[model samples]
Target: MKRTVRNLLALTLVLAAGAAAKADEVLLQSAKSGLYVTVVNGTLAASAQDARQAVKLDTVRLEGNKIAFRDVRSGTYVRAGVGQGTMLATGSPHIRSWETFELDRTGRGEVALRSSQNGLYVRAGVGRGSHLAAVSERARDWETFRLVDVRNAGGHQDRPRPGQGNGNGNHNAGQGPDLSSLIGNYRITHVTADNGFLVPLGRELAGRARMSIEGRGNLSATAGCNSISARIAVENGRFQTRSQPMSTKMGCVIRGQSLVENRISQILTEARTVQRDGRIVTLRARNGAELLKLRRM
Candidate 1:
């Protein structure tokens, strides 16, 4: 009977089933606070229902019969140190030895991740400045997390539907919202200032700077440091601006605001795609990298 069962498991169909169960995206929900485990500011924290905080458990890269969890946002590994507990940092020589985890599954799709470095399980530390901590590996409720598929989770911007025109297939019949309708004050919410870096607009900057999309393909923007103006082109949901946005040479006391101003202008110059959902507008590169997210003010 054992030989028969082994032969059955070796079948191609059975192997395919096993492969399907292994690769998946899951949000590690803390058992204590009911918050999902996510990496924020290079530290592990429990986020309140944000699907962007999801991480993937790599089935490959086995560390002594274990796996590794990597943060989707920063492309960094979740690792632990002897006294530092768990943190999100790039895999370097100093941290190369501690990036693996042993996944322990429980009933109802819940799991516990054990640190391969110290043989401790990750515990959700609650409250302000609370980060994930590695403690003694034991049967504890605080160490377990529910694996939630991001598609089922709420509070995140839905991905654009598969279509070529204006993000929602408005170009199906060449009918879409008028470009003049986009003329208004908008607040910058997110910025992909450079390659591989996504920076959420700081509260100070978000309120100070505003983007004004003029009806005649002209842009009048305020970035706290200077007033900016430029001409932009839009056709069939594609967006582009000629040359760099010209900014008034005004000096500012707050250097941070000036930096944000420059960053926003840089993104607008390279804008390739535009999508609007109600009062929110998202701009993306030709390659679909999100350049900016703006909310109508």
Candidate 2:
């Protein structure tokens, strides 16, 4: 009888341990973009491809059925911006009003995050640098996300060390490619849609479209209409740019120049990966769509 009681206690302890592990970490995937929430330079972005690259967040349950997301990478809690500021960032070390959120589970196996500070819904702003913000008045498709339990789903792994590969044949140690090699002038040679159809550029504008990657993460480009500049970063084999790129206010007189300028800006802001082959470089979106092709100048 004593032995049987000891076995029952052991089983209870094991089950409790499993439940605790399952309650801690989760990967939040956006239902709108189908991308995972990630942190880029202390800001919340939703663009990770898989669980390996997604930011692991500790789910802290509160008393009122609310929860807080603590980014394991930065050791900071996710905070919603104040009045007139909608951007969400991860820098709060403690749980505050802005750091707490309500997790509303949809009936369809998804959830929405509502900020406790402003009562706004968090949204995955896809084209706008894929940054997350808490400005939605209502929970829509963009505000819906899937909470993936790390322990049960087998999605959690120790981050790869600086010199070790993550079993994907990439030897960069998950730090992304060296940016120094990509610093130079590149002439825009081709633009393609998602369906592989070439987007025709005006003859005059096509000849002058150019981009320059300077040191210190500065990128400037011109599609023959106006010049645009933005700060960029590469993290975990992903390319990221500022949501709002600064641009010149010049009016376009060249035919199709405005369209091309807008297209180029969209491509740069939405770029997910950078691939180089000799004198050619390609920028692709998160959906594996080729956005831009350039030749070294």
Q: Which is the leading candidate under TM-score?
A: 1
Please, what are the lDDT tens digits per residue for candidate 2 over residues 56-131?
7788776456777776655666778732446666556566667778889886899999988789999898344577
| lDDT assessment of candidate 1 | 0.59
The residue ranges of model 1 lying beyond 4 angstroms of the native Cα positions read 1-27, 32-58, 70-109, 114-140, 148-181, 188-207, 216-220, 228-250, 266-295
Give the TM-score comparing model 1 with the true structure, all chains together.
0.48
Candidate with top lDDT is 2
User: Per-candidate TM vs. native?
Assistant: 0.48, 0.47
User: Clash number for model 2?
Assistant: 0
lDDT of 1 by residue, 232-260 (tens): 87665677786568888888776577777
lDDT of each: 0.59, 0.68
Q: What's the count of clashing pairs in each model shown?
A: 0, 0
Instruction: Write down the RMSD of candidate 1 (Cα, Å).
Output: 11.6
